[model samples]
Target: MRHARDFAVTVLVLGLLGVVAGVLWSLLAPRPPYVMTGEGPFLADPSTQALIADDGWFAVVTGAIGLACGAVGYSLSRRGRPLAVVLGLAAGGLLASYLATLVGGAVNLAPASITASGKAVSVFPGPLALTAHGVMYAWPTLAVGLFFALEGIAGYRDSPLRTPFGGQDPYGPLSSYDISDR
Candidate 1:
C-alpha cells in the first residue's frame, strides 16, 4: 500500500509538471482552425454549419463544467498534498478534454446546418489530430486525478477489497525473515 501511495504520488507530481508544460505549449504553439492555416474558415455545408454552432455551445457548456471539475479536483485533493491539487485539476481538465472525444458519440449529434449567402454547408467541430491530443495528454491528466480521488476515498487503505495492500507479512512468507531467538 505504501508502494502504491508512492507510485501515485510520483504520478501526481508528473501530472502537475504536465499541466504546466501543456499550458505553456498550447500558449506558445496554438493549432488551427485557431491560427492562420492555409485553408481558411471551413465553409461548412448546411448540416455541418448547424453542427458547429450547436457544438460551439457544447464547447462553452463543457468548458464551464470543466472549470467546475477543476475546482472540485483542487479542493478535494487538498486533503492530501498541496501539490496534489494539480493532480485533481489536471484530471478534470483531461476529463473535460476527453469529452471532446465522446461529443460525437455521447450524443446523437448532427453537424451544424447553415444556409447563408446561398452557400449551404455543414460543419462539425473538433480539429484534426484531436484524437492524438486526447490520447497523449488526457490519459495522464485523468490518471493522476483518479489517483488522488482514490486516496481520498480510503480505497487505497486496508479493507476486504484490498487485504493484501497493507504492509504486513503473509503467514506463509513470514518464515523467510524470522529473526527471533525463541
Candidate 2:
C-alpha cells in the first residue's frame, strides 16, 4: 500500500514537472516569421517537421525534460527501486510532451488573420497544424537512462567497505581518535 502511494505521488509530481517543461519548450521554441497575403482567408499550416528540421529544438526540449525527470525519479525512489521512478517518468513524460506539443502547435508559420485595413491584419486564435515525430519519446528514454546512471553512482558511493580496528571507530582508525572517547 505504501509503495502504491509512493508511486502515485511520484507520478503526480512528475506530471506537474512535465507541464512546466512543456510550457517552457513552447515559450522558447522559435518559429519562422511569415506574413499572410490579403488575397483570401489563409490557412497557415506549420508542421513540426520544419520546426525541428531547422535546429532540432524539440529534441533539445525533450532531452532537458528527460534529465529533470531522471533527477526527480532518483530523489523519489531512494528507498525503493529506480525502476518504479522510471516507469512513472515515462508515463508522465509522454502525457506532458503531448500537451506541450499541442500548446506549441498553436504558433503557426503565418499568423491567423481575422480583419485587415491596409497592410496590417488582426490575428485570430486557432489550432496549430503541427505533427509529432519520434521526438516525443525521447524524454522517457533519456529519463530512464539517467535514472539508472544515477542509481549506479549512488550505489558505488555506498559500496565502500568499512572495517573496525579498535575502540568505537567504525572504520578502525586509532584508539586516540576513537569517537567513543568523545
Number of the top-ranking candidate, with lDDT as the measure: 2
TM-score of 1: 0.32
Q: Taking the tens digit of each residue's C-alpha lDDT, what string does model 1 give over 1-182?
A: 54355336544544454444334333322122221225755533333344344334334434444444444545555465545455435554554344444433333323455555797644434242232232435344444545456556665464655655454655657556657865
User: TM-score of each candidate?
Assistant: 0.32, 0.62
- Reference-based lDDT, residue 39, model 2: 81
TM-score, structure 2 vs. true = 0.62
What is the Å distance of residue 134 in model 2 from its true position?
0.8
User: Candidate 2: worst 10 consecutive residues by lDDT?
Assistant: 122-131
Root mean square deviation (Cα) for candidate 1: 14.2
Error of 2 at 44 (Å): 7.8
- Tens-digit lDDT string for candidate 2 (1-182): 66666666667776676666556665666544343557843434454244444236666877787887788778878876656667777776777666667656644344555544565564433333234567778777788889888888877766644322432566454554755767
Q: lDDT per model, in order? A: 0.44, 0.64
